[model samples]
Target: MLDFYTNPMSRGQTVRWMLEEVGADYQERLMNWGPSMKGTDYKKINPMGKVPAIVHEGRVVTECAAICAYLADAFPDAKLAPPPAARHDYYRWLFFAAGPLEQAVTAKSFGWTPTKEQSGVAGFGTYDLVVETMEGLLLSRAYVCGDAFTAADVYFGAQVLWGTRFGSLPSLHAFTDYAERLKGRPAYQKAKARDDALIAEGQAST
Candidate 1:
């Protein structure tokens, strides 16, 4: 069985949506922020003490993108990923969305502006480049890799949702259109509804 450790409010939701997409039989261990994660036992599972870690096939995988990729490979029957022949774009867009886009948006959200010289040397390029690159790819097709939906979409779509939520990325017509399309998916709807309800409950208790 696949073991997934996560907090519903975090990036862990991305992996949860992927698991739902893959229709994998798995178990979820929810870690609520403070005490559960700080314990030594949890640290052994994920030293970073981050949510969205997974243990599968005797290997522990951390990070949302990595877990998504690993699940695609682990459950070949789900066909959540492209075949080996079509893997170039698959890996390219996956890591691209995971790294540059996520980093750049997060930095912008926090109001951090790197120096001109520093920006050129940084890993995420510039904010404009990040937005333009994503806009170009998304404006071209319904999904990232042409017509079919893949695991890359899971990561990319999540990043887009988060970026838009935090007001980091532009809420362009194309982005709004795409997000609507993604939300139409049953898995996305299910995961989001559950998380929303959980948040509501937490707020009520407090």
Candidate 2:
């Protein structure tokens, strides 16, 4: 069984959603921020002191996209990922969403506008470029890699959902339609509902 270390409100939600998608049997070890993550204990799992780390077969997997991709490949029966033949696009968009989209959206959200000189040196290039590129690609397909729903969609779809919700990306027909399509997935809804309930409980307790 996989050991999942997570916080209800962190990027761990991405892993949680992917675990549901792959239908993997997993154990959840919830960790609180600060002490639980910062102290000596959790640092043994992830030196970065981040949530959403998973232990599978005694190996630790960090990063939300990597964790999701790893599980999709590990559990071939789930069919969450494409076969080795279709790996090119599968790997392509997965990293694209993680590297470019994640950094771009985060920088933009925090009002960290970069100048042309700074953009060249930064990882995301520019927020406008990232948003336009994403809009162009998603507009051309029902999902990132194509029509089929793969683990890539789980990452890209979540980004779209976040971008749309936070007013970071344009609420174009492409984004809206893509979100509407993902809305019908039972796993997505189940994962989201579970996390939302936990978040509500945490808030009430505080």
Candidate 3:
């Protein structure tokens, strides 16, 4: 069984959703933000002290996109990834979301808007460009790679869901429609319910 280390309120939710999608049985180890996460033991799993790390077969995987991709391939029966020949868009959009999209959203959250000249140097080019590009991508299809929902959607959808919720991304029709489709998934519902309960419990204890 896989061992999942996560916080209810972190990117861990993204991994949890992916796990549920693949129907993988995992043992969850909930960690708090400070001592529990920054402690030496947890640090061994992820030296960066980030949540949503996973240990399986004695190997550790960190980062949300990596974890989602790992789980999808690890459990091929779930068919979350497309075959090699047709995976161009799959890989493209996945890394795009992980790199440029994440950086743009995070930078915006901190009010660090890049100057037009600086945007040229930035990996994302510019925040508006990132948003518009993603919007165009989603506008073309139901899922990231097309009609078939792949592990790429798991990562991309989570970003859109979180981005829209936090007001980092606009609630355009494409984003909302895609998010609504993702929300309708049973796996998504289950993960959200589980995390919601955990969040409530943590709050009550605090």
- The lDDT leader among the candidates is 3
Candidate 2 least-lDDT 10 residues: 161-170
Task: Evaluate all candidate structures by whole-model CA lDDT and list the values in order.
Answer: 0.86, 0.87, 0.94
RMSD of 1: 1.3
- Candidate 1 lowest-lDDT run of ten: 159-168
lDDT of 3 by residue, 1-206 (tens): 79999999999999999999999989999998899899999999999988989999899999999999999999999999999899899999999999999999989888899998999899998889999999999999999989999999999999999988889899999999999999999999999999999999989998
Per-residue lDDT, model 2, residue 99, is 96
Report the Cα RMSD per candidate. 1.3, 1.3, 0.7
Candidate 1 Cα outliers beyond 4 Å, as residue runs = none
Score candidate 2 by lDDT. Answer: 0.87
Predicted candidate 2 versus true structure: per-residue lDDT over 1-206, tens digit per residue: 79999988888888888888888888989898879988898899999999989999999999988998998989888888987888788888899999988898889878998999999998889998987888788778888878889998888888888778778777988898998898788888888888888899999999
lDDT per residue, candidate 1, 1-206, as tens digits?
A: 78888877888889989988888877888898898987789999988888988888679999888888888998889898898998888899999988898789878878887788988888888888889998988889988888888999899999888777777788987788788889899988888887788778878998
Ranking by TM-score: 3, 1, 2
Better candidate by TM-score, 1 or 3: 3
